[model samples]
Target: MQPSKLRKRIGGEDDDGRHARFLQIGVPRGVLRCRRGPMDSANDSVEKKHRKVLSDLAWAMHKLPPKTYSLSVEDGAQDAFCDWAEAYWEKADQPTTKPLLAALYNKLPDHATKLSGTLHLVNEYDPDNSDQWHPSKTIPLSVIRLALAIIDCLVVEAERFHANTDDLEAQAIARFKELPPVEWTWDKFKAKCKDPIRKEGSKLWTNVVTAMRDAGIGEVTKSKPLTFRRHTDVDGHRKMSA
Candidate 1:
């Protein structure tokens, strides 16, 4: 008896140019055959698994500290951590929930310590506030600072781990680093405005300078030197302006 021909389904048609179908070889003795499925389910399953692993790895790396180390989170760890963070934030502001708040508060100091200055900003600005203060309008400058620190730490960690973080995350880290630390003193503020090396013309600087001017600190000006500098002599010595 001749061996049965192995036929494959291709483009809704069979190898022999007819609609796909199962083939059977029969002999007076015995024979058997089977048809292939319309889709490659096994390949699809493998691809899905690969994507899940990559996503989990990326999330885990993002939560890690920016230091050289071999650490990994278990499957579903990211989801669990997020759920816990949500629950913690939900109870943070309730006066009666002191115990719960205490537990979560303890965790933050360690995480904050591990983060860089920028990532700490993100953590502080994490909008899931349980307080009366609105996150949109009243988040503290310290919180913003901490949240930015946290983001910076995460990006550095991602690179250290060779995790595939998105471009947006990397860009955020870059932008945060570009921001200069706030200068509350009039002299420091004026120096910042005039510093060509610091890119002080950014929108962040513009907004901050505007706010200070509105509060009567002194407006930014190109026509004349900064108020703090107007009193300085041409030789870079301090003198009262006439």
Candidate 2:
């Protein structure tokens, strides 16, 4: 169910300088509703809820087609970031040990401003050099909530990969869709299309392939003409061959 691995074909080949372009999507807040459960302790319940929402979001991204979006480096870094953030806060003796990201989904603050306030402390977070977070810790909302500083990093980095990705794709697909139908093997389609399809934007091949797939262009198979032959045998009986 975890689809982060599913990005391999489209977003996986990050080795040769071709990194994934993280697509920016606004997940509906309604979709993020928490699944209710019994709480063991104070902050433990908060973390449990947050973790569930994270899982749902990850699943949503996974259920999308391989061509739907590209992976960002920040996609899977949530846990480490939270732990590291908490470790940093620990030394400072902040009123609460629970990272802001550890907040319940409904209570989780704005993604931007809350993160900006504490990012300067990320370097100080080394678990080997610091104490770790425990599941049973009690954190009340009354304390100053200095949250998951790294998720701010994720959302911030998330901003980088989406420079007109959607617009460019819509344009490319619109252009390709207008072309006259032809014998549309991939190579043939490329030869017929220009720029985005032919050369310019080949780095995102899925977009190009998607255009063709959705546009419904391809060669149709035709039946060959049937032929029959007759030969006389020595017994004077005729037999037909196809």
Candidate 3:
């Protein structure tokens, strides 16, 4: 009887080697004739397993939403990654599978750092209020710092202009990083923060001015009590006209 195609391809003229391979392995010669070579079967299986592992990791990343009060989505995502790594690390053969799982695990620390900073800002500032002036739920802390720096410049300019915040916004925006131009106003400033950062800024500004007065840093211009007006922008903005 003629040898099968797989056997002929591998064994070729080495008929002795072919019989030795066929007999050495317990798989019947008939079975070798009926099935694909072992190498081909193994390659296909590895490919399928590699794809499944990738798909599972992608799904886990997708499930992690933004963190919120009483819900640490960042923590949840970290746990998911840990679970995936533990489950697949032992089974991961470098042959067909990429080390993408390990790469993502490495990025976990960076993600945690940002989440921790945002949570601290939120908890410290808007402990009760839920408004746009709060730390943004979606915006990164770096961006928030940019906004705060811009505001500080504005306040400094406002003070320079004898507490008149009227037209100082445009000048401040021009000097700082150019965000898409919005009509400059105190209300607009509040809107930028989303709630947390703004609340914290307000608290800190008030506290500092009060502390300064207590320490007699600035003179009390208005009432009999040692009180200093932190803000002086007129109109609907948090302006205290002494």
Tens digits of per-residue lDDT, candidate 1, 1-242, equal 22212212122223352221111222322235675778788998999987876565445445645543211133443343445445545655567644422344335433533343333333333223323222222233344344435543543442322221222233322332343433233334434343432342343344444333443433345423232112111222233569
**Candidate 2 local Cα displacement, residue 103, angstroms:** 27
TM-score result, candidate 1: 0.16
Question: Worst lDDT window (10 residues) for model 2?
Answer: 225-234
RMSD of each: 30.9, 21.5, 34.7
Model 3 lDDT per residue over 1-242, tens place: 22233333533243333221121111221113465555687878999987875565445434445556232344453344345335434434445533332333233333434444444453444322323234434434443343334433433332222222212332332221232322232334445443433444443333333433443334345443323432222221233459
lDDT values of the candidates?
0.37, 0.37, 0.37
Range of the 10 consecutive residues with the lowest summed lDDT in candidate 3: 22-31
Model 2 pairs whose backbones collide: 100-147, 101-148
- Selected candidate, larger TM-score, 2 vs 3: 2
Error of 2 at 222 (Å): 17
- Lowest-sum lDDT 10-residue window in model 1: 228-237
Tens digits of per-residue lDDT for model 2, 165-193: 44455555555455554333344445656
